[model samples]
Target: MIDWLDFVVLSLLALGVIFTVIRFVLGPKLSDRVVALDTFNMIIIGLIVFLALVFDSKLYLDIAIVYAVLAFLETIVFARYLEGKNNDNS
Candidate 1:
């Protein structure tokens, strides 16, 4: 049987992803959108970790670690691109 706590946790995570997506879409500036994207990635990582806990599996944990590294790299690359863009505009 499914537990009520599971529903609550999942609902909250879903809400987080939703809100971040909205921010990314509606943000006035590129930086705000990037930050929203980063937040969305973090929330996905949280969901993966939650899955690891729910399934009692280490594989999900490893996936989460790899995802985190990639997400960090992605954010860094985007930041560099934005930096270069801003420099060109100035």
Candidate 2:
């Protein structure tokens, strides 16, 4: 059965996503937007973990871990692109 704690955690995670999305939308710089995107990915990962707990399924946890790895790679790729762009500007 779902509990209050789960609900509370899910609520917090949802709020986090909303705030990060706002940041992503209002970013004055591309770097700031990239960070916001990464943060959004992290919050989604948290949601996946929450789903896994609620469903009592290890598969969801596994999915979350794989998603986390992908998100990390995505962040690295964005950072590299920014770095190259900055170097070209200099």
C-alpha lDDT values of all predictions = 0.96, 0.93
- Residue pairs with clashing backbones, model 2: none
Q: Show pairs that collide, candidate 1.
A: none
- Candidate 1 per-residue lDDT, tens place, 46-71, comes to 99999998888999999999999999
Query: lDDT winner among the candidates?
Result: 1
Off by over 4 Å in 1: none
Model 2, range 8-85, lDDT digits (tens) per residue? 998989899999999999999999999999989988998998898798899998899999999999999999999999
Distance from true location, Cα of 30 in model 2, Å: 0.2
**Residue 14 lDDT (model 1):** 99
TM-score versus the correct structure, for each prediction: 0.93, 0.89
Q: By summed lDDT, which 10 consecutive residues of candidate 2 come out lowest?
A: 1-10
